[model samples]
Every structure is written in C-alpha cells, then in structure tokens.
Target: MRVLILGGTREARDLAAALVDEPGVTVTTSLAGRVRDPALPAGETVIGGFGGVAGLRAFLRARGIEAVVDATHPFAATMSAHAVAACAPPGHGDDPAGALAGDPAGPGSVPLLQLTRPGWTPGPGDDWHRARDLPAAADRARALCPPGRGVFVTTGRRQLAPFATDRDRHYLIRAVDPPTDVLPPRHTVVLDRGPYTVDGETRLLRAHDVRVLVTKDSGGALTVAKLDAARTLGLPVVMVDRPAATGPVPPTWPDVAGVLAALRGLAAGGQAAPPA
Candidate 1:
C-alpha cells in the first residue's frame, strides 16, 4: 500500500512515523515549506507545494500513490479542500462550499482521508468571545482590552494586517516566525514555538499584563496552554472560529490512531489501486 500524507502538524508527522512501520506500506510526507525549519517525519519526505490540483494529480500519478491522508493543520482549509478536489472520483463536479475544482489523480479511485483534532470549547470560568474572522477578532480585542493593558495575539504571524489599524491597545504578538506583514504602530514580536505548559503560559501572560487573548481555534494540545492560562487569569479571549469547510468531505478522523485503523481497513480491502 502506497500512501501520501499532506503534512505539517504533529499529527501528520506522527501518522507518517506510524505508517512507515506498517508492513507493505510506503509512506511519503509532503510539507508546505512555510516554516523555516520543520520537525521532519520518518520515511520519505517531499518539501514545498505540488503547485495546484493539476500539479497534485500529476505528482500522484508519477509517484503511483494509492492513498492520501490530509493531516494538515485545522486552519489549512485551502490544502484540505484541494485534496478533496484532486482525489475526487469520476464525475464529482459539484462545488457546494466554494471549493476549488480538482482533477482526479488517475483512472481508479485514489482514496483520501483527513485527520483533524477537535476544536477548543469555552468551559466554566472562561470569558470567551467568538469572532467570525481575524478582522472581527481585532475589533473585539480592542473593545475588551483597556488602553493601558496589552493584547496577546497568537493568530500566527500571517494575516496580522487586520490588527494594524487598531492602535488603541498595545499588541504582543507571538509566533513561530517573525511576522513580515504590516504590524500595529505599537507592537512587540516574540519568536517562539509551542507545546508550552500552563505555568509558562501564565508567566508570559502576567509579564505582558495581557487583558485580551486573541487566537484562532486551531485545535490540538501544542498551543492550548494559552487558553488555559487565560482562564486562570480571568482574561477575556477573542477567538477566530475555524472557517467552515468547503468542498467534498473525506473520511475524517480526530486522531492518528483512528486514521491508522482506517488505513489498515483500506489495505485489507485493497481499497485503492496504484495508477497504471
């Protein structure tokens, strides 16, 4: 069984590691290359984009990939949508959720799966304010945070221009990479990566005197400490909801183990055949 894993997140890496150990399974992981230095997965690895759906289809045919597992970040809606399009079976012409149309990889069905972690939910003692997008979140953050208190922004470095116009509150932006986009007039950048602890998150929040926490609902435990720290500090959070999924959905799982089980089932059933 040949497999292609559209990867970036830890889940994708773990899935690749697990699949490589399986008998008769040839696993290859593809990364978007947005990050400067990424934690590579076990087995064959391909860096950079496949261009688009047509390019992806050509790659799949050339590599003889039998199956695809899109274990990308929850916020990577475009890639996920493209995977559905590129792997769609014959005559799947409908585009309900504004998905980009894709060309099939080959003659027969090239089975695709998705692994997504569950989103965070507001619990007791959580002052949560949901925003439709980053612009909305920026507006809500300014309103909730007083002039003197700073706002901790963790919605990644990209697309931060939405918050640039709001200079009423000082912004403390944290990301794995330094943002290259237009930043707010008064803002500080902290270059860091996650899997952070609650204690560390609390200390960071305390040091900045952050009154408002702005982040995306990009689920998983790696960066969830910020949410917990905000709860402990009684800080209001302005969360940008995950974009509604567009395009044909695949067999989606919440964890690596579940995806492994499904792949085992596929291998047993000889679900996908390598393009000839």
Candidate 2:
C-alpha cells in the first residue's frame, strides 16, 4: 500500500512514526516548505508545493499514490481545496454556486482523509476574545490593553503585518524564523519554535510583562503551554479564528491514533473507513 501524507503538524509526524513498522506499507510525507527548518518525518519526504491542482494531479498520477492524508494546519484552506481538486476525476468540473467555486471534487475520487486536532475551548478563569481574522485580532488586542502595554504575539511570521500598525503597544513576537519586514518600532522578535514548556512560557510572559496575548486558534498540545501561562497570569487572549475549509471536505480525524487505525484497516483490504 502506498500513502501520501500532506504533513506539517505534530499529528502528521506521529502518524509517520506509527507507520514505520507496518508491513508492506510505504509512506511518503509531503511538506509545504513554508517553515525555514521543518522537522523531518520518519519516511520518504518531499518538500515544496506541487504548483496547483493540475500539477498535483500530474504528480499523483505519475507517483502512483494510492491514498492521500491531508494533515495540514487548519488555516491552510487553500492547500486543502487544491488537494480535493487534484484528486477528482479527470473531467470533473468546478461548482459555480459553492463556497469554493474555483476547485471541486467529485464522489468516488481518490481516497483522502483530513487529520485535524480539536480546537481549544475556554476554561474557567480564562479571558478569551475571539476574532474572525488577524486584523480583527490585532484591533481587539489593542482595544483590550492600555497604551504602551506589552503584548505577546504568536500568530506566525506571515500574519504579523496587521499587528505592526499598532505602534502604541509593545509586542513580543515569537516565530520559528526571524521576520524580514519592518515591524512596530516597539516590538521584540523572539526567534524560536515549540513544544514550549509551561514554565518557559510563564517566565517569558512575566519577563516581558505581557498584558495581552495575540495568537491564532492553532489547537495542539505543543503550543497550549502559552495559553496555560496566560491563564495563570490572568491575561486576556485575542485568538484569531481558523479559516473555514473550502471545496469538498474530506472525512476528518481529531488524532493520529484514529488515522493510524484507518490506514491499517485500508492496508488490510478493508474499505477506507471514516475515523470514529
């Protein structure tokens, strides 16, 4: 059995690790190459984009990929749409009236599954402010804080432009790679990546005297420490909402274990059943 895993997140890594010992199964992990130094999975790997839907279809047909598992970030709606379009039958047409008119997938297409981690829910003593997008989150963060207050921003490097307009608030920005573009004059960039610890997060927050935290709702255990630290300090969080999936949505699993079980069943001659 051949599997192509669209990977970037921790769940994708876990799935790749889990499949290492499976008999007669070959796994190839594909990364988008957005991160400067992405952690490699334990299998054959390919880096960078496949052009678009047409390019992806050509590659899949050429490579004889039997199944596809889209384990990308929830915010990666464009890539998800392209995957669906690429997997559709040769003559499949787009849906003009649907949300994703540019891309569409027909029924009985290539087997595709989406592996997503559950979103975080606000618990007791947590002060959460939700925003529809990055701009909204930045505005909300500014509104929630007094002038010149420190804010911790962890919404990745690409989305920092909106927050850069707020010159009054000081920002402690954290990302895997350093930002190249100019930011707010009062901001400090912390070049790093996670699995962050609660102690480290708490110390960082306290040391910066962060009055607010601005982040995307990228729900996973790896970055949840920041949320925990914020809660402990009674700080307000401005969370940017995840973009809705475009085009035909594939069956989704919330964890790597469920995806592994489904893949194993498929390898054993069973149908590619949806994760329960």
Candidate 3:
C-alpha cells in the first residue's frame, strides 16, 4: 500500500519511523519547508508545497497514493484542508468541509486520516491572556513592558516580522533557527530547538524576568512548558488562537499512539478502504 504522510514535526518523524519497516507499505513524508534543518524522516521525503488541492490531487493520482495521513502541525490549516479537498471527489461545489456538494466521484474516494495532539488547557494559577491574532498578541506583549522587560516571543518565525515591525520594542525571540527573511529589529536571537520542559521554561522565564510571553496555541505538551512558566511567574501571556481548519474534519487521533491504532485497523483492510 502506498501512503503519503504530511509532516513538519517530530511527531511526524515518529510516525514515519514506526511505519518504515512495515512490509509492502511505502511511506512518503512531505514537509512544509517552514523549518530549517528539519528532522528528516525515514523512506521517501518530499519538501515544499503541493500547489494546493489541485496539485495535490494530481500528485496523488500520479503517485498512485492509496491512503493519506495528515500529521502536520495543528496550526497548519491550509494544507490540511487541501489534503481533504484533493481526496474528496472533485468539485462537488460545496464548501471545503465534507458536504455532499463537492465529490465529483459522487461517493467513493481515497481515505484520509488526521493525527492531532491534544490542545493545552489552563490550570489553576495560570495567568492566561488570549489574543485573537498574532498582531494583537504582539501589541499586547509590547504594551506590557516598555523596554528591558525580557520579552519572550514564541509565535514562530512566520509572524515574527510583525512583532519586529515595532522597532522601538526589544524582544528575545526563540526559534529553532534564525529567521531567514524579514524580521523585527532590536531583538536577541536564540537559536535552539523546542519540546521544552516546565522546569526548563520556568528557569528561562525567571532568569530573563520575562514580563510578557507570546506564542501560538500549537497544542501538545512538548511546547506547552512555557505556558506553565508564564502562569508561575505571573507573567502576561499573549496567546494566538489556532486557526479554524477548512474542509472535512477527519477522525482526529489524540496522539501518535492513536494514529498507530488507526493504521493497524487500516492495515487489516478494516478501515483504509471503506466499502462503496
């Protein structure tokens, strides 16, 4: 069976690793090319965009892809929607979500699966400040401290340019690698990897006297340690809400383990190809 895996994180790697040895199963992991020096997966790997749903559909048909599993970052809404649209019967004319409107094939189409980690919930003693968008988050973060407040910006490199737009403000940005293109000035760049711990995050927050924190709701425990630290330090956290996913909302696995279980079910011919 041929499987295409949309990947950009370690969880994707883990899933690829688990499936690498499966007999008669060929796994290809597609990266979003947002990260620098991403953790490579085993087996076939493809980087860059799929040119949206149409391009993805063509690729799937050309590749003879039998099944698709979307293991992208929870925040990667566009690609997720594209995956569903491509797999669904062409041009049913309905909204991106699985309405009867689109489906050119009428009913039968390829199987699509989603692997999503659980989102973070605030606990007691958590000083959570919610922002509707990234720009708002940056504005709030800047307003919290005039200068030298040791701001921590973890909103990923994509939105960093906006925060940096406020040149008068100084920020301590944390990303896996230094941002390539446009970025805000007056910032200290910290090049390190994530999946940090609460203890480690707390230490970093306290050490920097971080008065304000900014990050996206990217869900999963590995990156949520800073949220806890923000709560502990009584620091104001400017959180960007996750974007709404467009298209059919497939069965969402709680984690990689659940994904494995689903894969097993599919492997048994019990799930992958649902009867027409």
Point to the candidate with the largest lDDT.
1
Clashing pairs in 3: 89-104, 92-101, 92-102, 164-184
Q: For candidate 1, write residues 197-224 as lDDT tens digits.
A: 9999999999988999999999898999
lDDT value for model 2: 0.82
As a TM-score, model 2 comes out at 0.92
- Every model: Cα RMSD to truth: 4.3, 3.5, 3.6
lDDT against the true structure, per candidate, is 0.84, 0.82, 0.75
Query: For candidate 3, lDDT tens digit of each residue in 1-276?
Result: 788899987778888998888877889999988776888999899999989888888898889876678899888888888887787766642443342112124443556778777667778877677887887887788888767567888866666666767766567788887766467777777778877888999988777667888888888767878887788778877778888755458767666777766666666775632211
Model 1 bad stretches (over 4 Å): 90-106, 270-276
Query: How much is the lDDT of residue 89 in candidate 3?
Result: 63
TM-score against native, each model: 0.92, 0.92, 0.86
Off by over 4 Å in 2: 93-108
**Candidates sorted by TM-score, best first:** 2, 1, 3
Candidate with better TM-score, 1 vs 3 = 1
Clashes of each: 0, 0, 4
Question: Could you tell me which residue pairs clash in candidate 1?
Answer: none
Report lDDT (Cα) of residue 148, candidate 3.
53
Query: If both were scored by TM-score, which would come out higher, candidate 2 or candidate 3?
Result: 2
Which residue pairs show backbone clashes in model 2? none
